[model samples]
Target chain A: MTGPGRPAAVTGIGLAVSGLGTPDDLLQPDGAEEAFDPATGLTGRAMRHKDRASRFALRAAADALRDAGLLTGATFAGPASRTCVVVSTNFGNLDSVCTFADTIAEDSVLGLSPLGLPHTSSNSVAGWLAIEYGLRGPNLTVCNGGTGGLDALFWARAMIAADRADVALVVGVEPDTAPVARLVGHRPRLDGAAAVVLESVPHRRSRGAPPRAVITACTHGAALPDAVRAVRGTDRQPVGLWLTPAGPRPGDAASSWCATTRDLTARLGECSGALGVLQCVAGVSYLDASGPGAVLATSADGPDHTAVAALLLTAPGQAS
Target chain B: MSCVITGMGAVAAVGGGPEQIFTALCAGTSGLTKLRAFDLNRYRAHHAYEIDDRTGPGRDEPLRATRWLVDAVEQACADGGLTPAARVPVLLGTTLREQRSVELWWRGEGEVSAADLHFGPALRRRFGFTRTYTFANACAATLYALGLATDLLDLGMADAVVVAGTDAITESAFGTLDRVQNRTPEALRPFDRARAGMLMGEGASAVVVRRDGDGDRPALARIRGVSMNCDAYHPTAPDPAGIAAAMHAAHTRAGLGPDEIDLVMLHGSGTELNDAAEATALHAVFGDAAARPLMTAIKSMTGHTLGGSGLLSLIVAVLSLHRGVVPPIAGLTDPADEAAGLRLVSGTAATAPLRTAQVDAFGFGGINAVAVVERS
Candidate 1:
């Protein structure tokens, strides 16, 4: 229920990508890690038990929770029933599914590894995250192709708005299986995951958590006007423009009116599942210097007859 | 605002349409047959509740699941007096996407084409839908999709939304069943003494939901509320507490108390774990209440359709509420202790003044969901 002044506040961020180092490293020229492993942040039997995709999501989820201070001792404040997990992805654990299929084809179905059967689902990562963190709330996996990330964020916001959950964790993970990832036109090195923590304005303030920014609006469309109304008015100046890597560049006027364009795909590599959320987080960081920001993403559904668009507006949490 | 089920269609092992399915269930007809869609030499448990969904890739069918989906959507839209010209969105749920398509992809014969990804966009282009979505949350996916559809209608996002689900038995699923060793060599039985395992099942179902103020369209039943949550305990097993929590949440959201429910359709996959977990969940909620709703399991006839099972149960529940009869389990004997204090329909259909009913579904990955409906 975001209004003129009220918006959902972001308090935490976590990331796992092909690159090494840290979240900021993803923006650097040589950000892609030579051999970044999803098992780095996990431990014990879990690391051994899960697939690379689940491992990637687990690392990112842990980082996001830690950033939001939910991992340490935030449980005492909110009931597990008031917390939820929403995962966004286009193709679920393709690697494991393919492998499981191989085992079935080669060996007898009874000879296949039973433990590996669980990871073959589209929501396995979300289920594992819930089990690891004990977020026993509504678990959803939004898989509407490339638009999944923004849709997941919007879904989380809707959950909070509907009073379904007091706290929401939104994560997008895309683990590359060369064949499957290539279908979405992602590069081999684009294997990664990103997560954001969302809460109500009052909830953030009550927890004394410093706000990163306020997400004012998120909307999807079959199409949109060339110029957005969110960027109009002198007082409503935008700080930067965030665009999906494959998205077209904005007009000179729109670009100059805001900060430099932050091409998410360029910086993080073109990942279909993780691109939308990555762009949102990058916009938040870019807007930190000045004020608000806007991110626009579009995908061709079928000829020009059908198209999909996701637009998000963010404003500074602290008043000028 | 409330949502109502204006139209529903189901393609199960029993038959298509609520009346056909209801009649078959009443007559104790089971749909178990030898798996024929794919080569079953790679697995044990030769029997599966499978349909000869051979319409696909060519020969006017286009896709193996298209015929079942067509039957369901056509029935649902006709029942609701809805038309493709309205450009409504279709929200579909399935445990596994079209396995045939994926199998080819794995064998390097093809890739995950647009048609293989989701039924929504494809249906739109073919049937003139406004939008299409495919939810892949496994067993409880359809119930989840139902919840989302209800949310859309409640929010006025769409005047009428078509919630559908379809999945066909394939070599991969049968292989999984064989690996898990959760299939009954005896028979599909729920709450029975010899309820050893589940019988793999697959089919399709569709329902048309309209907003409360969408004119006097004569809804089949009023969709009171929907609740979906996860166990977070195990990947393939459901926690009874999680199941109870989902039911309680749905009740709270519908503004109804536990006593209001008079009938329930279970996830009962005919497996020991699923049945035991569901029974524990039921006991957790009812706690020996005098007016506890009679619990019924339809998997005895339809096997377990996985994601499609919940929506099938929903169609059956609607027909039961409308017809005033709870379809028997088809075949049941030697009730287990889990049947203690709870009425388990056996042999013949039971008649009751069922005003409120709930359809519960659980899936692999600890997915759990419930939908409550009241007589309109």
Candidate 2:
């Protein structure tokens, strides 16, 4: 693998999970609730036929821009052409897909709503995020396995490094609907969204936004140890903390490499698409509260997921 | 570092491989026929460009798109003369991925797991690819995936990447298209004066991309650049300004001017709005150039393969650049008024000393993606 490019600064964070007061709540031992209502703060006739995941995405994106000091009221404060959006959701729009299928089965082809058709397209969340905030730069949707969240963040970092965009609004959301439950066997999953404003150093500095954390490296590989090794590269200093999908096992190689390890899945339930962003938010919080440390975020390995994506986060102005 | 396509493969209604598809296009073959995926009764549109039973009949065996994808990827690997490596990443772009399988399960006609909705599980099991990324970026998904694949190579994340797009005709998308079009033409006639609307098609296309100097394989074509953007306009409507922006970005990144482009593969979904809007955008982008490129749409023959359409067009563009010939837009009785200044190839394949080409894919939600390719 090539050497890591210039670090990307995390300037803002947004959360829309049910019963969480803020992103910091993710660090708690338990969550408030397991279910979310899509109509909590979404209003107006524009949201008439919007799906639950799209609504969560819009809410989290707006909050992220606002948190980044790039949005005032309903207007975006940054250059629209240079700002992009990258969204991650494994099963975000299952409800809409199933609903449309049922509609066709119950009635006929003509019975389907034309307005509802766009949501069935998997990119609707990213499209809606861009349209709502007028982000005209590159737009993409990552719908892979559990690694999708980190994949989305890695894409944003790659885009910024390639000069495709100066700022990337990365959002990961998955809804807990009946159709999704039926397909996945009702395993408790996060029914909300988590977002982060990842920007180039110059862009963040120009806006005078304080960096919450700096992503020194992001790598994807066949396994977690290899990915973590790639992230660390030749740097021998062990990471201070590791926020992983599941807690470290007794014989895990990472536990010996890092000082502390926390299971994000156990603490926050099944975050799924929101896992990577939540890990970043928690990393920022940990660095802000403590001082001078690195946090590596990773997803759990599964038979369906043959890949592992890792993100290395360090405190502002600190080496990873 | 420059990215080049080492090998390419495609599976459409008209043909199975790149050479076969290109030959079929040069022969003005059309793949449109009566819709056999579902009951056509009570529907105004009764036709679609569908693959035959070679992959098995529709609905009876779900994951039809996955089958096509696997076939295309295997062909691409063989074409490149490269063995599957553990580090090779598979980047797949799809709209309605295996949603057809989900639909079958919803109707109690098949068994599908949540993991089966994507191609990762199937691909991992078959090829043992370590990392696979699936992008469901609507119709423009394939080109979008190409952009990421190029990035992965540039970033040294992988030695090479397998970029593929696959989609089967799903009932929901078909019903939605039927409702939106009101009536589907017997054949999709993109840019035609009497063109009605687009018909859904099923197929898969793949290309193995790597840094030019990284491997010893002969390069089929050089990928100059791939760019994508959101119109941030209406969800289902085409935006000329947005489309033009993506085209300009692609050209700028490729370091090529509009005059240098010899051919363009239009999105050309055969819909009235798409045709007019795409033509307008092309004019806006190439307005200052002295000679406009010869533009053609393969969807007129292959039909709209949705997510697979972009790479399908790109594969054809690569062949055109290599062969120095352009395929005709099949069944074009008369061109529309908006295509007045555009040089659209019709009737039969035309020869030109082509050096560079551009492929455009504009999708729902105003997602626009463009890619520039050149002869190796």
Candidate 3:
């Protein structure tokens, strides 16, 4: 295990959305449609047929792959060369799972749809990516509520450090689904997917690739004071995003805002897994000369909370 | 880095814990029985090694499989002399999460709310574990859980990690199995020439893991390597060549010639296609050793636990190390016609000093996981 100094570099990024179904369509002001859904409480045109999570994941994964130049045939040394996929979600296709459950309840003897069972699995997206990209390496799907995205990224970094995979595709995708909307007492809002291609710094520098974001540290737990103190001494002005029900407190807005999965879920309706991607988009949107802003994603259980804080620093000239 | 098995606990049809299951296995008594747990009037296949409600901690109300999982984890922690307050990160693997809820809903009883069904928080709450992770990838969930646990311990993420897996066959799951045409009507006979399909079983198993420090259980066996690969080649059927993700995992992790392995625990769904593909994969990985390693399929006895099958097989391998005996294949009357020189343990258990073993767990969506365990 290396120290906090060794950063987990983001070499590539990808995204797909309801308004923007593909990588090129994403972020285009006019091309994207207004994604809505009544069952999920989404108010925009959602992706057709494809589950919200898969669409979001494919979009983010494609963008990250393209950004890293991996799609362009660029290769890096270290774990990046043997890329793995880690996708995390809060509610993995609960709509589909519940649908299957409903079918079984209806007729015990009736045959269930083959397609539905496969889609209902939590790891369906990861399995799809592995098959779509032929990534026969380590593939995992983690479900830890809102903190899933941060956890996925942290796991990708650890996989790289452990020399398990050379390049890691860390994707967080949540889609607006009816069951998810009911569970959180709100519609899915701005359901999105974000992909970050992580690799070792040495490999990128050696390949003369365009510099990407440098992830300084990612720590998770209940104690925010200690994490806050660790990054306070840094030169960059970190912007924190909290996605909790209450939103960020008034004073916490200086560097931290209440940008949580619950907030994203409410806005995006059924998109519960892609909340992290929306947070990443929020983090990327806030990037400026303030250097790469620190994004902290937190979720709580009773008195305990799990916070994943990452220092997002863009390349020297690429700060936009 | 070597991965040690500090503690193990299992709940199965024949018994509630490891000792009971092992005793039944030693006696060559099958756990397969008529499905009295649930009314199977609509379905044809009624045989399953069902878990009695009173067997676990909470008996009054039919507890969710997650409760049994929590009990197993508690047993493992108690066996390892660790506490939940120690903050041991937990990894839970299961194919069906809160599936019993569907049955309850079918009966017009109270529905299992989303909060209770969601795995991550429910597990944390059940065990009072703070840092926890869960995987729901078909049959490969538990093996993948073990693989992730090993990686976490090796990376020093936590000094100790608890890996548990559970899957209780409910009426809803049985209906799905019946729909898929994968459920066997009578018994599970892995590699048997006349084998039809699989017998669904339910249970929970947990293993406590800690770094190999100065004083650890003498390192009973080392989890030398683990690999999880997706076939993505097919949704249900495995790749015909079987030279895909799972083969790579076995070869990559063990870094051993096929001859080095002493035994093989197969995914063995009792279907012709699955067994043939597995045999082919074994041939690719072991080459000559494919014929040499004492291949055994425990599913014939324990039934398929889906997510928990991988870890359950691994526990059996660990028991093989402890007892120095390889359990027999319960129902293999005739080997597959295309079977090569592969040695299938049948009828009686075999005594052998098992140094290295490979356990395989393949799932629906082309997910394949392999783990290599060895005597330290």
Q: Pick the candidate with the highest TM-score.
A: 2
Q: What DockQ number belongs to candidate 1? A: 0.43
Q: Rank by DockQ, descending?
A: 2, 1, 3
Off by over 4 Å in 3: A1-5, A19-52, A72-81, A186-192, A202-209, A224-272, A288-292, A301-320, B36-44, B54-63, B102-108, B170-173, B182-184, B214-216, B240-252
Worst 10 residues of 3 chain B by lDDT: B54-63
RMSD of 2: 2.2
| Proportion of true contacts reproduced by candidate 2 | 0.68
Cα error, residue B346 of model 1, in Å, equals 0.9
Error of 2 at B287 (Å): 1.5
Tell me the tens digit of each residue's lDDT in model 2 across B1-376.
Answer: 7999998999999999999999999889989888775876646788889998644443456878999999999999888866777778889999888888887888788888867777887887889886788899899999999998888788776788999999988777888778777566888999898898888888999999999976768999999999998899987898899999999999998999999998999999999899988988888889866247888999999999999899999999999998988889998879999878889999999998999999999898788999999999
Q: By the lDDT metric, which is better: model 1 or model 3?
A: 1
Q: Candidate 1 overall Cα lDDT vs. reference?
A: 0.71
Give the C-alpha lDDT of model 3: 0.65
Superposed model 1: Cα runs more than 4 Å off: A1-6, A29-44, A73-78, A181-189, A224-239, A247-262, A267-270, A289-292, A297-305, A318-320, B55-63, B84-89, B108-111, B182-186
* Per-residue C-alpha lDDT of model 1 across residues A101-202, encoded as one tens digit per residue: 677778768667777767656678788878877777778876666566776777777667666677888888877675465455545436778888888777
TM-score, A chain, model 1? 0.84
What is each candidate's fraction of native interface contacts (fnat)? 0.42, 0.68, 0.35
* Best-matching candidate per DockQ: 2
